[model samples]
Target chain A: MIYVKELCKTFRVARRDGGMKNTLKSFFHREYTEIHALDHLNFTIGEGEMVGYIGPNGAGKSSTVKVLSGILVPDSGICTVGGRVPWKERTAHVAQIGVVFGQRSQLWWDVPVIDTFTLLRDIYSVPETIYRRNLDELTEMLGLSQLLRTPTRQLSLGQRMRCEIAASLIHDPKILFLDEPTIGLDAVSKIAVRDFIKARNRERGTTVILTTHDMQDIEALTERILLIGRGRILRDGSLDALKREYMTERHMTVLCAGLDADTLSLPAGMTLSESHPDRAVFSLDTTVLPVSDAIAAVSAQTDIYDLSVENPSLDTLITHLYKEYEVG
Target chain B: MKQFKKVPAHRLYGTFFSMHLRAAMEYKSSFLMSFFGMTLTSLASFFAIWLLFDRFHTVDGYTLSEVLLCYSVILMGFSVSEIFLRGFDTFAGQVQSGSFDRLLLRPRSLLFSVLVSRMEFARTGRFLQGILVTAYAVTHADIVWTPARAGAYLLMLLGCCVFFSSLLILQAGVCFFTIEGLEVMNIFSHGGKELGSYPLDIYGSRPLILFFTFLVPLACAQYYPFLYLTGRADCGLYALTPLWTLAFLLVCIGVWRIGVRKYQSTGS
Candidate 1:
């Protein structure tokens, strides 16, 4: 339920050389350099579709979220979230969206988390019955029942984050924009958050657009992925398709009786990546040679005691993608 | 789509007010210290004025009680505005910290949200002190209290609050462009309060009076209304001069709207 076309936002930043004289001169006559935070960015997200927005730092991810949430006005673009121009019809538009900036806490610092939720309830004008239902459901799902009465400052980071998420959802927004929601959470907390998000998407059909650096989050939660870099969308496809394209090379680790890497002659696509007296690791290009053929080829050299094959992890694949795209 | 009723503005404001109160109550000792500290600070300023009045029985042809009346009106107006309009007063911090973005994400008037986001209840110290001083001035100033005079007095208090509150809003609007609060803005908000403690005509300069009357409109809230209240100005229209502050408020809100539209939120 989101449409964006030719979205452009440029920021003018002051530039100066580092010196007292230069600082003084620049103070009098400053120069400005314009950075395009969003450059003709275009994307369309359908209702109830969970899409992962992946990008490196300063890649317009947060800028895109801000524009969608009505926090920033783009220089030139047409963006309508659920048929409302975000900046033009901000109040009406924002009412249908929930945003969580992981780095910022929306809950009041010294008060119980429930206080902020009630404040949000009033702020969004959520009906009493709906508010009660949402609050009860969120409290149960996020395991916030025990934490709601604690002051926000007294809670641990993970507890605070759960409360933050609940606060954003108090109005039952149709669209959810979560920017780095899993950042800094422990593994258990991350899993909890991801599970809740998945269940929410499944049960309520909430349109979820998440931007995160954690590749596992993308792998676990989203079906569709939008890879952004340098203020532009570089890739848009399903996660499985992206994995298939990048997962051509499989790592084969074989524990054998005798393996002499220097004396071994390998197939054209297979290279011995690591070697020991009884263990050898091979990087096999499965596109050129199948896993079974590589296993047969290695078995001929030595008696195999143990063997394991692994596709590259999402983190490595993403790094490879970033390098290929020349983006950070 | 589920139909949602709009929450009244007063209810939203009450929620914010109670939230802030609860948050403040968490640090009870700190709140008490600051509350009393604020009262003592304003009381010291009033004591200084009392000393000055004792030394010079009549400065600028105005009696001690008349000066006290002017001072208390400005004091009450400024403190009351400071108590409620603290959100605008400290808006630069919100903009810098990205909390203003959170406000925009809500379905409410931006101005009203900013107005209620913060309430410096500690300033009630200054407010109560102002009330006491006004009680003293009202008894001693010897003004014949006609209904019109009473109405003008109430209007003066309201105009003073609006006048300072508008200045705070104007300063907040400037924060959108600068990203930091300018200390120079204090000259108008704080300095105007100090200068307005006495009637504008007592400044004894036509240019200064004209500046306050036309530019800042502080004289409209304070001087002209006081003149009508004290029977010094026979024109009934002087009582209506406080209405000029309303126009100033409108202008300030216009500037704020422009600032919001021009706002490029800080980087996340």
Candidate 2:
């Protein structure tokens, strides 16, 4: 339901040297440096697809979201959300999309959360029946019934984030753009948000484009992943495909009754990463030697008391990917 | 299937207005303090005008009531616009805080959204003061009130409101480019209200009168209409000169549109 091609946005930022004399000189002749916030970015998201947009800081993730959500006009590119150019037909295009900026709020402060919802209802021209239905459903799902009456400024951060999500969904937008929705949330709140998003995607088929630094959020909520860096899309594929490519090494931790310290010989595919009195951590290249073979090889030298083999976590794989792309 | 009925702009604005009222009511003590404070400050300015009239019985060949009439018209117009157009007055804050991005995400006119985002009901203090002064002027000024004069008076108030509102909009449009409100803009918005308190011709300068008459159109709402209202001008067309403020409104909207298209939202 979203198509973007050759999207480019450059920002001219003012620069000035420190010290009073330089400041005075620069005031008369200001200098600027152009930063490419988005550079020929291209991606297509299908309907009902929840995609994780992962990138490091200043990677143009938020810039891309702004362009698609009609908040920023790109210098040059063609972007159509559900067949409407966002910046060209903003009022019409925004009606079909919901956006939640985790760091920013859309709810009115010093007023009950419900007041903002009703204002949004009127703003989007949602039908009374639909508004009621959506409000009831969101209240139940987000556990907002108790919090709706509280002023936004009085609510805790997690409570406010839930209300922010509900406010965005009041109009039942077909597409949802969540920029770092799980940031600054406790574990329980994060899981609650992730579960609600997953359920919403499953039940209502809402297309979700989520950008978050939390790898667990990506692992739990999205099937497809779009990795961007330096204002360009570096990788775009299914999460499992990325895992398959980056998960070639398996970490093996073995607790053994070690009788020798420096006299042990290891196989070519297995390298001991860490060693202790009775425990040893091995990094095994599973492509060269399978997990079973690696375990058997370790068992030959030491009396194994306990053993565990694990694939690297998603966080490690992302860090590895970022390093591979030289984005960090 | 039930049809989704579209809410009219007026009803939506009413919703916003009532919400602002409720929000303001939350801080009753602060609201009252500011309301009275605003009244007293405006009264001080009116007191200055009263002292001037007392010292000079007729300044520029106009009676005290005539000057009071001009002052009240400008004062009432300014207060009305300040009450309703406060969003534009404080728009730089919205842009700086990135809240303006939220407005663009809604399915409504950006101008309408911004217009309803804020309202300074506290300015009703100045509005009431204007009414009191207008009442005193009407009772004391010797002028025949015909239907045309009444119409001219009503149009003058409306034109003045539009004139000030356009100035606020112009300043708000400038915020998109500069990202901060220019203090120089206050010279026109606040300064015009002070200068317009007296009839433009009383300024005794041709360029000053022409600047307000054609360039900014402040005199169109005050001077020309005041001339027709007081029977000083026989031409019926002077009464309609207040309509020129509409042209200024169009120009401001054009600038605002350009600003919106060129908007570069700050932060993520």
Candidate 3:
């Protein structure tokens, strides 16, 4: 559904120093530095795939989304979505794609959400029958039947985000480009949004390219992850592949009431430290020391109340990706 | 199963106007206040002349009625442009808020979307007052009412509307290139309305008249047409000078296209 090759975008940013004198000097003679927002970026997202596009701030994530959505024409390279170039065939290309910029709304501020949706139906030329069907489905699924009649300004952030999602889907677009959809949502709202997105992908075969700071969103929805930093696509592979590569050490905690920590039979490459009277922490190279063997060693030494092995969080892995990549 | 689908330009325009009407309805008090305020405020322009003629009895050799005819036409032209083309008038807001991006994303023409996104009903009341003032001017004027003369007045009104709208469009279009909207464009747009409220001849001719005539064609729509309407002009060609406003308008659209190209290239 999407194909991009060597997609490079450069912006000429005027360079100016701070302070009143420097600002005045800039008015007389300004210097500009060329910033490569996206450099030799390449990725292919197939139909019906929900991929999380995550990176640190100013990592060119929004730039990539803008380019793909035809909002910005790239300086170089070819980006094709559904066999049409985004910038070259914007009308036709955009007709098939839905974009929701979390910071900017597509709906009119003074009007009700439904009014904006109705206008969008006309703008997109969606058939009346199809518009009704989609509106009904999206409204009910997003729990937005009540919110539709309310003015956009009156909606809460969570409520408005739902409306934003619904607004984008009014055209029944095949591909959705969500730029930070879950940016400032509560945990419940975030999960609900994730569930709704997953359901959309499952039922309609909608292709979703989501850019977000929340790694949990990636863990929940996308099997594949695309990491970008400093205008470069550093990693592109499945989530487990990334987890295995960066997160080599696994930790386990055993909870035992009134147990001697030294009695724990530690694995060869493992060290046990008492965190609490009931809890002990052990480290193991997940590749060499199987989690079950380490757990068996602990259970043999102490009467276990409860125990669990935990993989490093997706957040930790992503933070490592950020530091390793040194996202500008 | 449908062979084809389309909304005719007239129908599209109807939809745009109705949507704006609905939007205006939502702001009932603001709409009503502005509507009343525009009518009263626009009347002040005529009162300036009414007070002047009260003192002097004439501007140059033109009487109150003749100058009223000129002011009415200019006011009518400006009010109509502002009413329908307000989207262009406030294009800076659209660009700054990024609503312009939403406009470009639609399948329809970007120009049409900008026009539809905003339509000020308040100016319609002002336009009605201007039209009424012009009608009063026509009753008092000495021109013989031939069908051709009637046609000329209607055509002149239309040509002036297009000309003013074109200026506003040209102003908005320049915002694309600069990434910032310039307020000075209003000098040509809003300022033109104020300037056209009188006989350009009173400002003296020299090269300015030639510049406004052959270049911008403001004189065509106002000065020459006013001369013909007031019996000062003898040639039939003078009656048709209002048509030059259309050509002048097309040039503005051309400039607008270049600005759009720059906007796409820079994408700032």
Evaluated with TM-score, which candidate comes out highest? 1
Give the residue spans of candidate 1 off by over 4 A: B264-268
| Per-residue lDDT of A177 in model 3 | 85
* lDDT per model vs. reference: 0.90, 0.90, 0.82
- Candidate 1 lDDT by residue in tens digits, B16-59: 99999999999999999999999999888888888998999888
| Candidate 2 chain A least-lDDT 10 residues | A258-267
lDDT of model number 3: 0.82
Output the worst ten-in-a-row residue range by lDDT, candidate 2 chain B. Answer: B259-268
Candidate 2 residue-wise lDDT, B1-268, digit = tens: 1235779999999999999998888889999999999999999989988899899888888888998989988998899889999999999999889888888888899999999989998888999999999899878887798999989988898899999999999999988888889998899989999998888888799999989988999999999989998999979899999899999999998998788877844332
Model 3: per-residue lDDT, tens digit, A14-88? 999899999999998989998888999999999999898988888899888878887788878888998888878
TM-score of each: 0.98, 0.96, 0.93
lDDT of 3 at B144: 86
Residue pairs with backbone atoms closer than 3 Å in model 1 (clashes): none
lDDT per residue, candidate 1, A1-328, as tens digits? 9999999988888999999999999988999998998999999999999999998898989899999998888889899999998988888988999999999888999998889988999999998898999999999999999999999999998888889988889998999999899999999999999999999999999999999999989999999999999889999999999888988989999999998777798888999888888998999988899999999998998899999999989989989999999998
User: What does the lDDT read for residue A266 in candidate 3?
Assistant: 62
Q: Which pairs of residues collide in candidate 2?
A: none
Error of 2 at B73 (Å): 1.1
Docking quality band of candidate 3, CAPRI definitions: acceptable
Error of 1 at A302 (Å): 1.0
Error of 2 at A108 (Å): 1.3
